[model samples]
Target chain A: MLRAAVEAGADAVYCGFQNATNARNFAGLNFTPKELQDGVAYAHTRGTKVLLALNSFASEGRFELWKHAAECGADCGVDAFIVADIGVASHLANQLPQQRLHLSVQAAASNPEAINFYCREFGIARAVLPRLLTITEIRNLKNEVDCEIETFVFGNHGLMVEGRCSLTNYAVGVSTNMDGACSPASHVRYERDATGGMTANLGDHVIDCFAPCDQAGYPTICKGRYRTPVREEPYYAFEEPVSINLMDMLPELIGAGVDAFKIEGRQRSRTYAGQVVGAFRKAIDAILAGQSPNPIDLIGLTEGHKQTQGAFLTKKWR
Target chain B: MSITPLAKLTLGPILFHWDAAAKCDFYARIADECPIDTVYIGEVVCSKRTPFFERHLPEVIERLERGGKTVVLSTLAEVVLPRERKMTTELCAQSDYLVEVNNGAGLGPIAGRPHRIGPTLNVYNVQSMVHLASRGADHFTLPAEIPGNVAALIGAAARPIGVGIEVQVFGRAPLALSARCFHARAHGRSKDDCRFVCEADPDGLQLSTLSGGPFLAINGIQTLSWGYVNLGAELDAMCAAGICYFRLMPHRTDMVTVAKIFFDRLAGLSSPDEAGACLSALGLGPFENGFWHGRAGHLYHTEPEH
Candidate 1:
């Protein structure tokens, strides 16, 4: 699936180590050292770049682990490193001066000054923009900054603070920034309530309860519904469980100087990755060729059986 | 062993609404009475509130500086408009005070300058911290959810690079910031035409779960933990971990007393128990330090030193 992504249209295939060195650190996903070496080789052979994700924050007294992971990734002959930490990025840039570095979206370098600083000091070649940008803001950022820009085109729409937010950790004791998992599956449990509805609980928090007819996604704190003083009823306080589909907005994003479009699931199955990557590849190619791309049939892949353009379509209330 | 008096106090930007006169009076009082070392002033929640405080900022900054406070201008948590970006850029260019890049929109203009990374910036690990420090960030205010161990590690790593670390100490913790304003939506108004109704609840409206348990608070688009976070007791552990600064976010209550409680704790004049008792008298709520101890943020895992 990764090889196909490179061959189809991807400029770079970003993957993470199996451990907590990356944000998508899940139970049965990501690459080992040997797997990363083989993956890099496969992409290199096909003239595609391999970007290693070491984006998760290194915990106290555990800096050496993240440092070693970077060294191993460099040894694997990866094309570039996507990083969020200043300490890690600086270490890699100082040790491997010739290696390319891309600021991970987790870094949340949303402004030109921040991007320029990364480029000048650590030689960052690209930055994965946070999902909070408007089309006009992207154009302005491109004009103000020298490095390449990447945007998320599909997957869970993260509306919280990118890179720095720890709301999940506050709620459930795990966070994507430190632990590389938000509302991790280990803490999640589903049980049939007295009403015969399945209640999904993350830690002690009941995130959602669904009837037999309802579809469910992973129980995340931000996607959970709650009753607020302003609203008399329970509604999504942060954001609804929705996937970001920019298939229709591809031309606009591309025209706004977006250098790359990122697909957000590394924990996804190889089949899911291949299908989404292939569809986006075709859509992007069609747009570049001045033809209207066919709408992607991605309803089956959506969470809660729904999708939205998220912040890209302006502010959402639900 | 006594903890060293190395904990620096920072005043976070006011996240609530106040009249221009009251806002001016707040800073005036901080300048005259608060023992805080740094004061962050500017609109962090909504841009509309910026205009109200904008006219008073220059004077307030002057007063703060006269009182020997290192003033900082903060940026909006969510920046979706071109004007908002422009405002961030202008604030960044104000060479008189350091800038706190709360969101990514503010980073571009102030990159490679001596700036403070706000909690909203979501810096969870050493790599992200080092990245910001290399970009001329001399200091960082970690996200509220960062565990003490992680904070200590980041602080230790940052020490060699000559970067300072600050953690949120008092006030309702800021959980999330979004483009949609629940305060306006609740009042049946759009964000574009929000009637400045957030002023109704200076400390944010408390939210309860469906079962009537306290869950969170809503201040505009931001979702905050309903429990106030008081780290007066964690000073020794944090100081041992190499943290140099502790931030107390502004609240509607007695901020001077809040600052004094921390000051007294640091001075050994008051124990963590005494400080915690005083915190209750200030009328916030039950306190929690679980997130600081690497537990649930809302859970009070550590027993207070009563």
Candidate 2:
């Protein structure tokens, strides 16, 4: 996937060790030490940077694990460490002064004060803004913050505040912030109901049910359907499963002083990531060259075959 | 055995959007009659709701202080707008009352100053706690879903730094926060034109599963557990684990009586079972204590299961 993304013209590719150190701690995903070394060597030769994601909040009495991951990532010659925890950032700033640090979106540094905190405390070179800000808010934020700003251009349009949400932890006891996995696959169960409907569950809790003709979505707690007294039928109380596609707003985001555009879904397939990256690279180049970019077809690849501009375009999304 | 049997009871800031008059009345009652030792005041959820109550803060603070309650101002849990940043900065700058920093945005201005870590900030490990403590945080309120083992470890780590650890022993656990206001959305309105729809549900609008089982509650942009978190059975265990403070999140219920019950429980005037029964008799629950047992937050683990 690193080679594919680099070849697809990604300036930087971020990945993680096969452990709880990163947010995408899915089984059969992520890299071993040798795999990371190989990926870094391959990307560096092609003028692409490899950023290590040590983004999960360290569990109590488990800071050594994150420290060890950071040491290993450094030894592997990665470009920078994308960190979320203050302890990890402080450690890197003091111990490995030369290593560049980027604040992960998992840090939820949505404001200038929060971004400045990391930049001042840990000498963070960049901060990934959470996906909750509108373009106007982003522009205002860029004026006050010292570090480079990165915003998500594509992928999951999470409704909840990053790093702060514990819906998954409340359900299955595995936390996205601490364990780096939300709605862990091990606890998810899909069962067929009597009426040819499907019920998806996380642990013993029923997250949602889909009729025979409906396409079932992942059993994330936020995307699930629930009943309320006001409505007779079950409804998506939080959000419907939709992917965020910001291709149309790329020019405005660039004008908002965004440093880089991030494409989420590290756990996705190489083919899909490469296709999306290649499409984005072309669009960005066209915009820089003062031309209207030709749109690329990515609807089929989106979750639930639906896409939304999310909270980026206007405050109406709220 | 409980190491600190006499933990202080605290009233967490009101998460719901009550009218200023209702808020003042609630606090006046709390200040005069409640046994709560510390009262956290400020808007911790939505930044838009701040203006409605900002004018009443000084009066509320004076009343609480006059009643011999230690008051702490809390910052917003999520800040994205410039005004929100300014609000956090100004809150951090105030030195009269200790501030509880809920978001990372609050940390910068309060750095090197004595403050408290609210449950919204992530302080899962000892290193994070130590680092924040070095930056002058004297106390912490763990996130609502933190399990007992992790809380015990954090409490143990906090001991050496002479910092206090607080856990929410009562309330509907705050499960998630979002930029989108579900309350307004449910009413077929956008957030900017919300018209204060959330003010209708004083205890948060309830959301149940499709099966009609209680699932979660929505209060504006924040999601809370449908079941009230009652850790009456684990109070002694928490105290033994070095937890010296218990917070009671204010709902529309009679919080004064709730605080008295918890105070009595801590003072050993009532047994755990007695306290648990009293809380149940209040009818504010279909109670849950699963997070303490390292299970689902909505589950109520029996004594045998524990």
Pick the DockQ winner. 2
TM-scores of all predicted structures: 0.90, 0.97
lDDT of each: 0.80, 0.89
**For residue B164, what is the lDDT in candidate 2?**
97
lDDT of 2: 0.89
Candidate 2 stretches greater than 4 Å from native: B1-6, B303-306
Q: Pick by lDDT: which candidate is best? A: 2
- Deviating ranges (above 4 Å) for candidate 1: A1-11, A315-318, B1-8, B65-70, B77-80, B101-117, B121-138, B153-164, B185-190, B303-306
- Per-residue accuracy of model 1 over A94-188 as CA lDDT, tens digit each: 88888899999887676676677678777899999878777777887899787998999998888765675666777787867777887788889
TM-score of 2: 0.97
What lDDT tens digits, residue by residue, belong to model 2 across residues A283-303?
999999999999888898898
CA RMSD of all predictions: 3.2, 1.9
